[model samples]
Target chain A: MPTEPLAKRPGGRSARVQAAVYQALTDLAGERDVTRLTIPAVAERAGVNPTTIYRRWGTLQALLAEVAVARGTDAPPSSSGDLRTDLEAYAVRTLADLTRPGGIAFFRAEVSPDIDERRSGLRECLQRATAGLDMVLEASRGRGETPPPAERLLDQIVAPLYFRVVFSVPDTDEAYARALVADLFSGTWHSAVELH
Target chain B: MPTEPLAKRPGGRSARVQAAVYQALTDLAGERDVTRLTIPAVAERAGVNPTTIYRRWGTLQALLAEVAVARGTDAPPSSSGDLRTDLEAYAVRTLADLTRPGGIAFFRAEVSPDIDERRSGLRECLQRATAGLDMVLEASRGRGETPPPAERLLDQIVAPLYFRVVFSVPDTDEAYARALVADLFSGTWHSAVELH
Candidate 1:
């Protein structure tokens, strides 16, 4: 049997429900497209009341959006001393993560504008997703290195990968990531303050 | 009366049905969350049989995916032959289009993985989206402008704006567009090819 997710959490009915629901979503998401996921199915798998999920999550998109948020951004590779190597590894890991079972569904589901207003947690989810990368920037800033501005980083590094992610075209391999870093380094981007 | 999309296309009962269905979807998508859109709702809106929609479009996602592709990439601004100004204008226009009523919905609908398997049309949609940018690249190549590699362009320019589009953060104004173009110009990305 697959490892049980809920068992790892603290003992409590509410906690159990969350663990089960998250686990069920994680498993089901891997096996099938997220569109096929319904609250009743999640309820059945989680052994919780469908009404509970309906009441808590309100909608399938809402439930799935939370599940995606719960998945969190797996931390990027442990940083080596070198910024370039670390950042490149970060980009590659991000691409690799998308191929993981629930990763694509999470992003694909998150991208929909329909869920935007309903899934109010989007900002939190993104903050969590970028938390790891932000740390890298913070570390560079601490070292007295002027890390690239967030806007420049978005344009040069994050956007290309996202564009590839959404389109599922053109490779986003190590070379691509390095090239992006190189492009940003080559240019004098707009001046930006360090992340506070 | 709502504007009809396929009015300019060739005529036929089948074509008329396609036009009506497409028009209905386009119109409905503007007012409501696409997740709430059901085939029956679309069928009633389009004045076509729901079964016909099921037979022809298969799933709501499948139908929506095509509608998105059908909505297509808007052509970029007319060029003034100055590469930097033209490209910046293109970027600004792309951002402006996203703010339009249905633009975000179409993209949100387009990115789902369920439809990825069905809509091989996604690639064509993207190609159409980039056709204008590609022309700029080709023109530069013709002018012996070394112009950064496609990967570089994707990372530095395309990715940044798209990041904003998906995340809906950090303004992507005309000023930002000009800055990105300026940054690219400042870089020694790739080797020597004179911009004519």
Candidate 2:
């Protein structure tokens, strides 16, 4: 028996509009604060009708949410069965994205808003990224590298990279990332249980 | 020997203006975005002449920078011989400050501005915090309770707490903080020198 090919969900006009909006957001990010980016400006820049942009996104904050989620979806997973290598790869990939022309600016915009809806979107993105890291750690343990608790992994390894990035400081380098992995795994590697 | 009170500096008027500006900034932070905050508004709220604020600080960014530095000066040092206890106390204190009314909002404003001068103030504050943490870690090592690599202490122990607080997430409780201490001490405490 032959297996069925995965069918693409029909996004149609909405998908095209989303792509255009994301492009506009990225473009605006290079020059100014994303919060100051108006829907009409984005529509004009993307060559879409302003009415269509508003009809679809409802608000600039809503459009920004979709764009933020889409940006994160593009990151490929890293699991090489080595925790140190995997984490370093994760850090490097994250650092590269954050240091890109629009990345840090986008992050700043996400958190700057005092509104709950906008803040929630940013929080959700953070939660997803953290969950992804948890999976990486789980995979490491499955391969016989019993690591410390998830909270610890988050605290010691993942959090600093972000602190440096969002706060606009030096990137947490390859050496620092690797040292984090080694420190976590030292003798405790034998005790780490694969997370279900 | 009893020392006489320090002589007042000739720049007392400038100092008073700076203090008043900071007071107005803090008060406005409770209700408005620091980005949109203006000199005339600050002077009126602070009960000082607009010319005084401008003449003393030169610009809004300069005044805000001074305020940021002043806010950071009161953070307690973290050395108490015991890394776990000291770090936990520090985390709790930092979290208390971050969650206080106008605290996180004030931080967001200073750090989120796209201008380099505004961001430099935040960077300096972070540097000071990092330096203080480094001192605490060094003290822990001197006690033979901490293992070698310095970066591990940063990545594993301190980084996560800072991340959670800055992101406005839930606090890392004492139990989790203690586990982090145990993980670092057991695993990478001795690995720092080896890496070098």
Candidate 3:
């Protein structure tokens, strides 16, 4: 069966431009290998000016990284009173975003020190990646628990979900998220804090 | 400074072929992106025949996957009776392997459903990826403690390490690995098992 070109509902003109560009980028990834992707082709498909893309993004890697940040993390953190549910929401959103059609490819490209030499706004993704964890950590503190260091929280909870997300290792689900968060809070949390 | 071509110490003929092929592959990845890699290009650089590559591996994806597995998994599991010590060794080795110059690129290329359509021998990497957790699980059973499911062990300990490895987010070290294993056994195991 022939595949259809990706199109989204019209929104603010700027949003529409970004969507068109990202959709075009992913569509090209579908037609051929992403390593062959060029900004001209993306602009052609996106129906935006190639010069504008160069002015805005400067490089294909930067464009992909921006698309990834836009499509993958548009949702705000869920603030369920229960920490487990909130954490699970973050996991589900992250997994869904990254594992989506073009999500993993973009981030994979973003992290490659070689392919992405510009090294532009990528640190913002790092911060965004942990924003949810920061929320989860705050909740832990509110529960009167001495939360493990941000480093530990990231390693224990956020890292695993992303590892699974990128590698397609374990199933990412609420159950999986809950089990991990619960384990962190169990006696492990206290001992881990002491280790720091 | 101009980069030098990747060369290896003289070895047996089989090792020579493997080294030549991997060096050619990474060199091409250096010259052009990996998605543009072809057996012909690899053959040209390696001074090996295209027919030989086709007969042996059948595709560029398989060849890259093999390179990743070979380069990345050369170290065997360190068997320390103490789970934390053992886990630390495993984590350190894994982070070192994947984050090395060519290692992450290979796996990132290896896992893509499109690039790796053959999906041949990729599971070995997955198995090797989890081998440490497997040993830890067995040790738990030996201690008469019901180990948390493989899923949990991965998410809690292994995932975080890989997450850091891939994204350069949280740092991976013996100290980080030890904290994770210690947390797993402290009191979380009992609760997680009961929940299961």
Scored by lDDT, the top model is 1
Candidate 1 lDDT, B1-196, residue by residue in tens: 3233444644687688888888888777776576657788889999999998999788776777777755544353565766777677766766666656666666666665564562454576566657767777777666666666665565656667767766766566667766666767766653355765
Write one digit per residue (lDDT tens) for candidate 1, span A1-196. Answer: 1222334545687777888888988887776566667788888998989998887777766677767665554453575766666677766666666656766667756665464553444565556647667777777777777777554565566667777766767665667767777655554543332222
Best by DockQ: 1
Clashing pairs in 3: none
Q: lDDT for each of the candidates?
A: 0.67, 0.64, 0.65
Error of 3 at B66 (Å): 1.4
**What 10-residue stretch in candidate 1 chain B is worst by lDDT?**
B1-10
Give the B-chain TM-score of model 1.
0.78
State the lDDT at A4 in candidate 1: 25
lDDT, model 1, position A57: 72
- Top TM-score: which candidate number? 1
Global local distance difference test of model 1: 0.67
Evaluated at residue A151, the lDDT of candidate 3 is 73
| Lowest-sum lDDT 10-residue window in model 2 chain A | A1-10
TM-score of 2: 0.73
